[model samples]
Target: MHKELRVAAYAVCVRDGQMLLARWVARDGGKRWTLPGGGMDHGEDPYDTVVREVEEETGYTVEPVALLGVDSMRRTHPRRLGAPVGFHGLRIVYEAHVTGGELRYETDGSTDMAAWHPLDEVSSLDRVGLVDVGLALWRERPGTGRVTGIPEHPADAGN
Candidate 1:
């Protein structure tokens, strides 16, 4: 089996009872609301990654204020033309505040749109599990930089 490791950074920007989100376009052509972040480039710092990704996806310049937590996940999936691969992902979640910039949809990117949604309505939207994880970390602010009991979203299993 093949193996791959991915490290990503995400930001939770909540303000005035709303949270900022980006619309991610999946490989299957489906879309889901997600935190404003993405995978890190080789040699990139997770902190810088979060700042850059948030701006790229949401058109908002943000300053990551706190290291919320890290979430590690593993999955197995078949490659398009090869054997099954084990994918390990380490997602760094941060609490960020918008410093500047306006809300605008991304162009020619993994995410196509950006918007702010009420925190109370987040659970009812079609979203990736990371959104919940980020929010949980933001809310609980656990000393261990981790949170538990976030259920996996069935539709997000392959993400």
Candidate 2:
């Protein structure tokens, strides 16, 4: 089994009662809406990672204004034949705002589209866990930089 850890940065950008989100294109061509961000490059700071990822995925220049919180999740899934691969993701969340750039779709990238959606309608959208976690941190503003009360996954309901 292969095991790995990934560190990522994500942003919550809200303006005019809407939130900026990118549609992530999975390898199988399915899509899910998510916050505008991605993994941190080697040797790059999380702050810079969020800025670069937002521009890459959403074509919007963002300035991270505050450190929101952090989320850590782990899962084991199939990779090799009947073998399980373990993965852990440590995500750093930030509160950001658009500084410049126009809305555009990311070409040849993990995300293919970006758009703003009404905040009240987010619950009906198919989204990744990061979105909920980011919003929780933004709304609750836990000074400890850790968001609680949201379940990480369906399996976590039992924990």
Candidate 3:
């Protein structure tokens, strides 16, 4: 039962209006709230994996600017605490524009905290549906669109 097809890269760092999140440990341990970015190191270049995962999970320094949707589905990689999933899960989602760093909180990496989450309180916290599919692909900046993944998960996003 191995049909893995993973390809990731995410970001949606708004500003003054607030958004720039990053607070990992999802997949059950709860407390999810993403945005910074991750995965994409094969031929590398999902916009350099969102500029090196937004400076390694929120040290800032973004600038992706567009391509704001592409979420593909098919589950079975949830119990991930380490890595190496097994199934289709292509996530591209971008729309950055931070320009610099300084938010801090890269506690040795895969994220811990970084602020600016006020896009109307970001669905009342407790996120994970890739934060409303990265704010609805950054407010349907959809020069394209497609979000269909739900064999079993995602439904905590409030607001």
CA lDDT of 54 in candidate 1?
92
- Scored by lDDT, model 1 comes in at 0.89
lDDT per residue, candidate 2, 82-122, as tens digits? 68878788898999999999999999888888999999999
Candidate 2, position 99, lDDT? 96
Question: lDDT by residue for model 3 over 89-122, one digit each (tens)?
Answer: 6778888788876878777665688688779988
Quantify all predictions' global Cα lDDT against the true fold. 0.89, 0.85, 0.71
Winning candidate number (TM-score): 1
Let me know the TM-score candidate 3 reaches against the reference structure: 0.32
The pairs that clash in candidate 2 are none
Q: Which structure is stronger by lDDT: 1 or 2?
A: 1
Candidate 1: where is the Cα deviation over 4 Å?
A: 154-159
Q: How many angstroms is residue 37 displaced in model 3 relative to the true structure, after the best TM-score fit?
A: 11
The candidate with the higher lDDT, 1 or 3, is 1
lDDT of 3: 0.71
Model 2 misplaced stretches (Cα beyond 4 Å): 80-82, 153-159
